[model samples]
Target: MAQAARLDIMSIAALVAFALTLGARTTFCEGISCGPGWEAFSSSCYKKMVDPNGWLGARFHCVLEGGDLVSFNSSAEEDFVKGKMGARSFWIGLSNLECNHKLCPQVSGKELKWSDNTLLNHSNWATVKVASTNLESCAYVLPNAHKDYHPGKWRKVSCESSLAYMCKRSPDGCQEGQPCNKTAGLALTPVQTSACDPGDFLRGHFCYRFENTKKTWQGAEDDCVLWGGHLASVHSREDGDWLIAHMEDNFHVGLKKNIKMFEWRDKTAMDPALWYPGYPSSDDCGRVSRTGQVYNHQCNSLIVFTCQKGVDVTHRHHQAHLVCAHLRSFSHPCSPAHSTSAAPRLE
Candidate 1:
């Protein structure tokens, strides 16, 4: 009997714990409690009193309880309060004390700006005119059926008339300047680098290279010029280092084949001094093989070729048909020499 009783007690305790856990996830709306004519918005409560008080007096009332007159931005927000509080007229936080004489003069004094700072402009006014006499020279916000202002409009009204007024209390349920930190049990981590890098110029992170033997050095240079780039030249040691590191073992630089005679495309009468050591003499012109191996070939042999700039680290197999420099000052205009009439082979 004692064992059965112990099991029953354990079951009861488990049920109570489960109920508490479920209750923790539920949100309750207690509605506004500020007198009979007030409405609630989320956690804060608002009331529209029928006793017409001047704007200054209304503001003072709100301030006394650590609150302020309501300032609304969107139709949804207005409708939300109206739906909750039911149709009633109320005084809002707007007044026409500044620039009152001008046609459609804006009420200038905004004690605080909303996050979007839209209320600072005060342009969304209702079109109806407030009679000069009723012109408490102020504006009141209305709600529900009595909330009959033109949609997307505002109206100026009098402060002395006994109309319901709105009151908004801070949702924190605490006084200002008190610490209201909620994440007492949690921690946050910092990011080490920005999500993106700055100064990245390459498109699709790629560079191109081109090859030609049908033209003389001058003609070849012209071909490059027409294509918006010059003969690919290394601008800095960093560039050279990148090329050396990324290039395949048998890659060619700038040599051309002429019936077994080899020469640099730049046409400088030097002893092929620029050729990286054991290169150029292996063949006269450059050609990238099917396996991406670069070697010197006879110039007369019309092997379709081009020089490429940088290699894309992400995709090593992809090759560029033409290489171009990213110039700093002068912009170069070059178009592809080959026509799109013929489909390109992947190899």
Candidate 2:
């Protein structure tokens, strides 16, 4: 009878423990809080920046603060946004276009996708079909821009159009410094060396430098050109990842709003893979954070920027020397050319 009583007590204890575990998870939202000036709702936090920027610039500011443009998942969330936005139009996290390349690629389908890859289960478009033209694929919500700004109505616009943007973040993820760390054990393969001037770092086929002086977007671009390169054109996720790994603070990227879609300064199609997702819209220029996310912003804003230049002939000769060094090490198959000259080491 004593054993039976103890067993019954153990079962009750276990049941109570399970209840406590469930309760803690339910209260996690309570424990997590947004940063100052950010509003909290459910499990996420939001802040509306009144500064005018292209869609990309707005998204960059949010990412710099550890979030992205707000993405809506339900009618309630949409309604909540409507209430928060009040009578002003603002950029959201929806865009049908991707522009990391020199040119914006045509999407296969007309359906709009969220930059954050949120599920497209619910929508509150003002029109039955979203107008996704080749040049205008970035989206925004017009809750009360005017009497005609239908509540909950969505509009697709050219990414270059500047407007105030809204940012959203989950309170659980808000604690802060650099969120992405240099990946251990995954050594990047050295592709080429450069005779880049002091302060420049070589990565793959190009050399990059973060200028100390701040300038307006156009002025920055001009400076890059004068230094024998253009503003950096990030082509892939690898590029973005590598960039953020080495860069600090928010800086201008190379994307600019064209007639309809965003384009790289060099006129190449953008690699969608480089974006943080749901980005590069309704802005004439781009900005990046230490997190490696790309965002739209205004062209006239004064900010620090990055630059890129191709390896010159001196670097090419260094690459040849490296190739010769590899051949010399394999003495069994060493050729006369390898034996005649000592391999020059490139720093």
> What is each predicted model's overall lDDT from 0 to 1?
0.35, 0.55
Best by lDDT: 2
lDDT string, candidate 1, 47-104, tens digits = 5544444343444344333345566755556666555434444556665433211111
Best by TM-score: 2
Candidate 2 residue-wise lDDT, 1-347, digit = tens: 11211221222222222222333333222234675778887767888777555454455445445566788888787778678777555677776544211112233234567655677788777668765433334577755322332444776653323456677777775323212101111111212222344335445445676675788889999999999998998776556654554443577878887787778887896666666667766667888755566788888888888898764534334433553344334331222111222112111
Candidate 1 is scored at a TM of 0.29
RMSD of 1: 31.6
Number of backbone collisions per candidate: 27, 22
